[model samples]
Target: MVLPHRLSPMVSAFTALWKQRASLKTLILGDFTQNYLASYLGFAWAVLGPLVMIGVMTAVFQFGFRAGTTGSAGIPFPLWLACGMVPWQYMAEGFVTGAGAITAYRFLVRKAVFRMGYLPAIRLLAGSIIHGILLIFLVVLLFCYGASPSWHWLQVVYYFCCMFLLLLGAAWCSAAVSVFIPDIVSVISIGVNLGFWLTPIFWNLSMLPENWQIVMQLNPAHYIVQGYRDSLVEHRWLWDRPLLAHVVFFIWLFAALFIGAQIFKKLRPHFADVL
Candidate 1:
């Protein structure tokens, strides 16, 4: 079936990427290694960096702020916090790095044969390697806290896919636009930092009034964060959440992908010139 003219560019980009899936894998793995090539610990930093951040955040909130007393589903506060923080680290890193994906590889942007479309996915997937390790750490932490594995744990993959697609859309837009407006990278960085607090990583949504909770749920990151807690700590399925939350989350997800794709496609032709 023929796609509308507006969607053809977006669809074509995906088609090209699939055709070169092997190269995409090589690029992602290569980029992931180069990310830590100069460090003494090498790839271990992928696991260590986030673990340190989680440890520090857990200390400050659980101990310093006395937030440990509030546990979700009787899960320990640290475990609950890890569940949220693990996915959040992926989202935050994906946004910051993905925004710069195109700029960071400007040499490739000028290559006529290169598919610039793969840049954002390269950064995102590279970061996913780190994300997968952090997730393992989270599972061990949960087990240490006496939380047993359950079928609901499988939902983490579903949530990860949700977050990945959401980021891909946003990344395509930001990476494309950042070519012309360099400040967009900084803007996204600031937004992600603010999003960390605004999102309920350290706190629970139940702390808010019912009406306000609805408002907070509108944040796409809120859905992913809450989904992590539900899957790991609360042992609930995705459908178990309010129907409205699912609707709102997907609304944001598709809107991001659709709008981002159009914006990326529209600006793509000019990227070579800007770079």
Candidate 2:
């Protein structure tokens, strides 16, 4: 009585999950509420958490350690750092969370009735909310600093979508691989931690010798971080990215998605056995 699915795996997977979208949304929203909004000023913690860290970092670097004191244009170091950090916070969350999605919901994986390919999409849904709050906080800080709004600032929306697309692709790869290699979860954690310092978030990329810039730009997160700072603090357009940067980012993105989809479909049937 098992009728084989005639649709392509991707289409068949979507066909299975499409009907559950409503329930899934409700489940995700409910989880978000419980985790971040259930207590007094609970959700407020999301914004306050990063703001506090940024403040401490600013104070430490500007006073105690005396690093990243130089800011681009007239923008302060903290402001510039915050703009980049906002996107990174969301991006890191998606990647880290997605990597554990399969293991975290092992019960669902065993059910064999649920469509697992959407795990990456589901991982970042709640994260986008936190990203919005951080965006507002960044804007308020800029306004308080007497920065004027400009047409270029409007490109944050484009950059937001850009980061999300990047997140989707990365999430797919991380989620799929981690199911097979549990150590990938730890790898992602250590990688994100190390990547923060390695990336040009706290320090400007210009600090490096001009010749070494492309090497650092190899990290796709660098492109997004730079995009955020350029849009918010430097007032640059989305299309203004260098040609090579565009080529590298798109290549990594599409490749991640294509390979991720293939791996996800191939190993998906075996999830129950391992889980």
Candidate 3:
């Protein structure tokens, strides 16, 4: 059967990524080596960068602001903050870097044989490498806080997939657009910084009034952050959340993916000229 012309680029992009998975792995590793080659600490920065950020935030909020354990579960504020911050750092880095994936690899874009589509995925996967390490740190923190492993802990995989897909969609769109308008990268950086506070990473939803809580839940990041807390701290299953929460998150996720694909498809032909 033939795919519709409109869907061909999207289907082909995914198919090519799978076929070239080996090359993708090589490119991702190359990025890691190139990134830290100049630093004395080398690849360790991947782990230390986030750990330092989380440590400072924990200090400022848990100690300076005296923001006690914010969740209803009474998990240590530092642990709760780490759970949210770990996944968030992954998303934030993916957004900022993925937006520039096209321009960053213009040489590949110029080559007729290479697919520019892989650039965004390369950025995302590279960030995932670091994300996995941070997750280990989060698990150790959880153990230190006396939190026992539970079946709910498996939901971290679900939430990680959720974030990856959401970021991929957003990356596809932002990356394609940034090729033409370089300013989009700075715009994304600003948005991610603002999103850090707006998404309730350090704060709990219960602190808000019922109506405000409903409004805040519409932000998809809220679902992922809260999902992390649920999996690691609260021991609640995905179904334990209100139905509306699930619906809102998937709606945003799918919408982002569909729209991002369409935009990337339309703008893809022009990438070579612009870049």
Whole-model Cα lDDT per candidate? 0.87, 0.78, 0.87
**Candidate 3 accuracy as TM-score:** 0.93
Weakest 10 consecutive residues of candidate 3 by summed lDDT = 34-43
Q: Tell me each candidate's TM-score.
A: 0.94, 0.86, 0.93
Per-residue lDDT of 116 in model 2:
81
- The true-structure Cα RMSD of candidate 3 reads 1.8
The order by descending TM-score is 1, 3, 2
Q: What's the CA RMSD for each of the models?
A: 1.6, 4.2, 1.8
* Residue lDDT tens for model 2, 1-275: 55335325545555655788896797578657765789988788876887887888799887787664455666777887798789889887778887877777687786666678766667677778888889988989999988888787878887777777677667767787787899998999999899988898777788899788879999889888888888888877767778899899888776666666667777877888887
User: Which residue segments of model 1 deviate by more than 4 Å?
Assistant: none
Compared with the true structure, the alpha-carbon lDDT of candidate 3 equals 0.87
Against the correct fold, how does model 1 do in TM-score?
0.94
Which candidate tops TM-score?
Answer: 1
